[model samples]
Target chain A: MPRQIRRWGPPLLLISPSLIIIGVFVYGLIAININTSMTDIHTAAQATGRKPSEFVGLVNYTDLLASPAFQHSLRNLVLYTVVFLVGTMVMGFVWAWLLDRPARGEGIFRSVYLFPMAVSFIASGVVWRWLLNSNQGENASGLNRLFQILGVPFLQNNWWNNVNYGIAAIAIPAIWQLSGYVMALFLAGFRGIPEELREAGRIDGASEWKLYRYVLFPQLSPVALSAVVIIGHMSLKAFDLIMSISKPANYQTKVPAVDMYVFKSAFNYADAAAVGVILLVIVAILIVPYLVHTARAEKS
Target chain B: MRRMAAVAAVAAVTLGLAACSSGGDDEATSTSTGTEAGSGGDVEVFTWWAAGSEKLGLDALVGVFETQHPEYTFVNGAVAGGAGSAAKDLLQSRLQANDPPDTFQAHAGKELTDYIDAGQLEDVSALYDDYDLTDVFPPTLLDLLTVDGMIYSIPSNIHRSNMVWANPAVLTEAGLDPAATYDSIEAWFPALDAVQATGKTALSVATTWTQVNLLETILMSDLGPESYNGLWDGTTDWSSTEVTAALTDFEKLMSYTNTDRDGLDWPEATQLVIDGGAAFNVMGDWAVAAFEEQDKVAGTDYIYFPVPGSADLFGFLADSFTLPVGAPNPDGAKAWLDTVGSLEGQTAFNQAKGSIPARTDADPADFSEYQQSAIKAYAQDTIVPSLAHGAAASITVLTAISDATSKFTTGASDLATYQSELAAAAGS
Candidate 1:
């Protein structure tokens, strides 16, 4: 036992700092959050340690599940996720395909496309708030003004202000902000592909379109999966963008994260924590599969 | 020899990191202790008046605090946001951690009840007696401040939330009289229709809270001040025909508002009125400062009035300061509260804030024309709490109502659903 301790002690000590930090900050907090979610604590006094909170079992969770606001937020999340995922992937793939070949000012175009990623979601949301202004007629502004100037007034429509699918419109800005990042990922994937594969496809009498459809597209699956996961988790956790554009109370753009914020600000900690737990479970469901797949891939 | 050296290196790095973290903790402790050691200490007054006209109001108030309490250093702990939402969140966390600030701003009605019930605020009834504020503040205002004969906060200023700001130019273009007073909200609808006929928005509303503000005024109009106040206390039924009529009026008024109402803030909606894009906006008296910022004269450029049927009623919300139960500097906090409730402090703050002083004795000559009218009206008017401004309800109820209103305004929910949701919120 002493010999084993001597052999393992140095390495264990080396990693102990990081392990301890993550244990306390990450897992410990999550455990506390879950515990809080199951309690009946909703006041600042209880939250701050002035008053004791009672264990209420799943009451908060049941309440949230029955809430119309929470239900609507979940629906909004599904719509936002679908649009954000599809929009970013398609736009990113197209941009990468266009830029795959060597061209004049390639560096400038690449820089211009990636520049938006440098701005924070809050900052971009502020600009996009104006850009997506839904007012028409004499009060036409933002994108509506642009469409009018371009003589494409038919395209003028209420962007995020449209009640039926306003959350989908919010995804437009998310796509605008993140599609460039997806493009960067796809571009790297394209560049990493061996030229010999294309040469081999050419020798097989494959057309350029056919060559990409069979060879290039298959090779880019990993990149696409990664982009989806990254953007998927972001959309699930989206708060600042929606807040900066619309408000937390706005049903048009509100999601579970925004609802969590509203609950938190209202000092309904149990409800907020319940919403948080739901969001965490959702993100975990999306991520755990990818993590397992990656683990399997590494083992092989 | 090599293995020993590696082990030594790892131990040294870990120890260094531990030392660095401990060093940070020590520095933090030392600074905090240093601040607490002084005779007067630091009085950190937490508020959301961090920018624009609100910031100026706070600054003027701070100037009075400094002059009144020269021994203590005034720490401006202002967090900028609309309606103190962001600041309140931070304040809650601090209160939870038992690290309350010396004093914080709170709205003056049922909103303070939350803090009082939580045992987070100190009862300032003694301060009221000591300062002789009972005689100075209006009885109505004092009654609103009191809960079970105990007051937790001192009123700084009063903001009338039922005021209608109309652009004279827009009304003239729409061929309607801007200065014309309507007996009820229904009486105002014809004026709204006339404005809409001219291809302009009749009522310029913004976001969820402003809609609630409008709803409160309409309720006050339809149900009368007594019934409207009863709605908060469970004395009036939310499902009653009177409330249904109020909701119908609210829905009708919504039709005349700007299409992109949710996309704009209160200032932007108010700006539409100033720029002749809309006929009128129902906002708090703070909009007067906003108009003055744009160099627009009241009465000439824009006219003010009570929202039609709510005349002779002051739908009000007051900004007040509280001494937390476990404040770091209680003596300094009481001094700050004394300054906040003082005649001089109210004058300086209200003049800059474009709000009327909570003190009835404040000279009207020190205020603008709009404030002068408000002061006169406030004396004679039946006082009612403003719902949107955190006076009539707790934050949780307000948030729930806001969520329902947002859905209703966005057409996600109908009036019936909204009424049920509001009833459910109140019941909760």
Candidate 2:
């Protein structure tokens, strides 16, 4: 064998299994979901050999578009995505910057920030629900308990009813769970910058702000993009937190995943599938371009 | 390297073939033995009761089944999603993969109808015949389990869905009679409201299926059972004034429920009534099992009645198990089904489940007072087909109602919109 070919062959062979695993588990499932969405197959129908394999030509899509629940969920998903993306990225970057500075108990602070992410979403959701329970009026769950203990009665009202503040209430858990991941990503990106680059900028009369704006910010793009993509995906598929917060009776907490579940249970699998397909499409539209670009960048 | 690649490809092909063969064997093993193979002779029964006293009732049932079939064990596939959302989908995917449990719980009627039609269910009609189920089983229970005149499942018990469970203490505190007919239940709503004013929940409607159940009760009681049954199997105008009135009344009733009720499961709502946390809980007869767990005696601690002030029509459905086509132990499954369906089995299972036996011959004395009352309604022919919600329509139709109801109760949608959406779903 030629030397160049011989050198790369073993590495390629070694990685093949992992590639196959990814192909079957990740990409394959996505393809299956997409294909199923094109048909009208539901749990019952699928059970009965009545699975609609023939193409219905976007009937499901049209139905989805006309669904008010779907529309509301889409709006919620977009709002969640934007809030989650902005909150995590900005807060995470800020925390990352703060942690990057020399300080006491940096390790403890880092661990504190990262601890929320370490816990399972299920556990986090339960804890958050207990903390956010509306019954805890002035002394009940969430900020109320904290406020009431401080003799601040005004802070104890139903936070869920305040449309203006409810999104923020819901967002708190998302940020709590996600900012750490973002911070970690940003930390890695920040640390990648050579100390000499900062020193050179400093020696050239660049202030701290200016050094970051031009040098640091641009270098963090890839990391921020990565964070945005991941957090956005997580936010889009967010189920547990919203469910924990929003009782079915409260019009405030209804999200797409909850609705998907209700629809699925009610045996409205078509509607559920439609919701799922729309979610999948939304995520793909959000992330695929970045993924392709990243892959191309890596290849080059 | 090319040779190695070729060898690796061969290995892949071989392993793939092996996987396919193993899967085929696994399926054969499961399918051939039928229902006998429940989670490795440890029948992993999947249910939605993980809270409070339903858990106790389940424990009792498990104990009975275990004692009856010691060779078979039980695995708790008890998932905790209210309304059986997660577990049902999981069951569906498993059944689709032809890896269904030897036995799993199902609501008798259209829920199992799809499985029956798919030939995924073993008929077990002969088991019913052998069990001499006619004596103990009522025609209504049989009606729910039979599709195309063939019984596809064996119901463990009958749950009278129209029962309005009331706290006698709360009722007396409000100076209201607990034994009032369905029509009287609404009159008692003011009394319930009084209870609510006392800083307790007046009505424990969980604002999901419970709300739907309450609505069904109103329809059955006020609109008359004939018209209610017409809504399901017969032609009735859904937009009629009766439905409109029933829905409006239901809306008003919902106003009395706990603001946090939407997140509450039915059992939690029942717990409220049992704990004197709520005045009334309109749930199924099986709900008595919850109160019983607190050692509260029926007809004493709580008063059960049909939707009060309305007709005496009883709305009922059955909880049944279907033997999946590929159950690993079909013989054991058949044995399980035969044992469960027999007059003796029905008596034993129903007694534990706080449900009336599916068979007509199962001693009425074997049930609790609430169940005895339900059986009386059935005996008097007051028990109508429950198709209005549970038994009335196919699962597809029931789901449509549930979804529309969920949205409607949440105030995300309203009545006219609900009706139209329901119509669309039914037509779909």
Candidate 3:
């Protein structure tokens, strides 16, 4: 105990600077945002003078909850999150499994699969925006054009412009970009599983499919869970991808992050802050429980 | 590969910094970057036209303005955005921070209300008399800029919003005459059908603000000038069948638009019309400059007419400048304003801007055939303010209306619901 006490001071000193920085930049800003949201400040109020906003308790939150725009955005965020997470996970696992085998050019295929990860989401978004454009016939030069060349007119849907599948369409580019990273995660997890486990399954007369279904998949759940956490938070705070890919005021693709931006520009400071807080609460709902379970699992 | 991702991350930070660099919340207006405002050494003229002919137009004006005042430096601090959204945001932040530029561009009417109510703009009513601008500018245009018996901004130029640019050859191919004009909104249906039969998208529009342009034109055609003007204040009832009819026509208009429009901007939409991929585009007269820049001759490569049934009305919006309150150099700002609202400034700026000079006295020969027609139309037709471009309504109201229009254009909302939502927006 005495030795542990003596060792603590240097470690404490080592972490203090980052702690202070995070405290000021992240937590301090968050608190200020929350305080700002609990008021009646708006564009008109702010323009007259940046006054100390009169406290209005939960009025901003109440108004946001009642607003159709906010409700629509929340719905989009949920839909976008589900499709992105599942799409990335499935694509990642498939890519990992294909490349995990002993094959000639495995290194080349692996590099090719990982290339999209190198490009930023915004960069991918701009390119995909054109490729997925809903223009028809000669004007269409992207995915729709390929469909035309393939003689499969049925495959030529309005990609992202179709609002019913708009959120899902956004997920396609996202999955394309992040699935390679997810594959890296799964590949690591696959490598971490000792040969003995597979050998035991093989000794039991289990085929590769059976081994994958029962043994391999169950063991990768932890890695999958971690990937979900990473991707989940990303989808919650999604701004740049949507901004680059879609129209700014496109209600079909609007999410809370975009709502925050639109509101901020209009000088509806209180509403903007409310959107920020709602985003925080959602991220917390998704991540806090996963973090707690992971901590407990590590301890156990 | 890692370097590329790092660059993307940096790009995101650069955008954030640009937003914050609206001069921050320090409340310090003075900077050493330009010549001191108090010294009469520099008069920073702010605008959103940092590139293309818009910039060229501003440079032309600056060239003229500089010749008039050799003692002062004219800093062209133009931030660029598709519309004025980016510049507006930057200007808003700077104004809030109390670091007003000596002069800034704004839409003349309701758009300047935020700055005025916030006490960011100085009343330049006296400059109107001193410069004899009351004689040069039309009373209708002057009336739009006046708020509570005081004029807040000096309009440099006027651009009619309800202009329809067409590819003459494409229309001729469709068996429609190159110079044809529809007498009503419903008349466009047969025309668009003919264009579509020729295997072209009948109409072209861009993503956000362009939808606003289309919506405003549709409203004016259906509602006429007096009722259309009533749509802004509490004078017209949005729940009336007239608005419902306008929304219906708006929906019909969207049916003819290019499906890939959400991926394009206004210029691209104009190019679509020019390239014969689309037959028609409802845009501001600025599309003339864009077409001219591409070496497309007017009346042959392309033709423009006011949107069907709206020829009797000049749906106008003005790009004007304001002498911001607490300007570092009031004399320099007054000089700039005098130049902006003056005959020489308006003529030079408008000739390059593809807009008609706000002053009626500008010689028509100095403008293009298209712009001369616009000037003649401005003189003969009844003037109505534009809702889409922030002339008829406040930004808050305009934003709400835009949201409804955007949603409706995307087929996210039906006509009746959009009508009610618009009513709620205007009433708010």
On TM-score, the candidate that comes out on top is 1
Off by over 4 Å in 1: A49-52, B1-39
Model 2 misplacement above 4 A = A1-12, A46-53, A135-169, A190-212, A243-277, A295-300, B1-86, B168-182, B297-302, B367-369, B385-389
lDDT of 3 by residue, A201-277 (tens): 99999998999999999999999999999999999998888888896788778899998888877778888899999
The interface root-mean-square deviations, each candidate in sequence, come to 4.8, 5.1, 7.7
Q: What is the TM-score of chain B alone in each candidate?
A: 0.91, 0.81, 0.91
lDDT of 1 by residue, B1-428 (tens): 97686556655565555567658865754565456533487889999998888888999998998898888889989988756888888888887655788899989988876688778898999999999899988888888778998988999999999989999998888887766889999899889999999998899999998999988888888899889989999999998988999999999999999988888889999999888889999998898888999898877888989999889899989999998876767888888998999999999998888898999998999988988999999999999999998899988788888888988999988999999998988866
For candidate 1, what is the lDDT?
0.88
Best by DockQ: 1
Best by lDDT: 1
Better of 1 and 3 by DockQ: 1
TM-score of chain A of 1: 0.96
Better of 1 and 2 by TM-score: 1
In order of DockQ, best first, we have 1, 2, 3
* lDDT (10s digit) by residue, model 1, range A219-241: 99998899999999998998888
- Judged by DockQ cut-offs, the docking class of candidate 3 is acceptable
Fold similarity of candidate 3's chain A to the true chain A, as a TM-score: 0.93
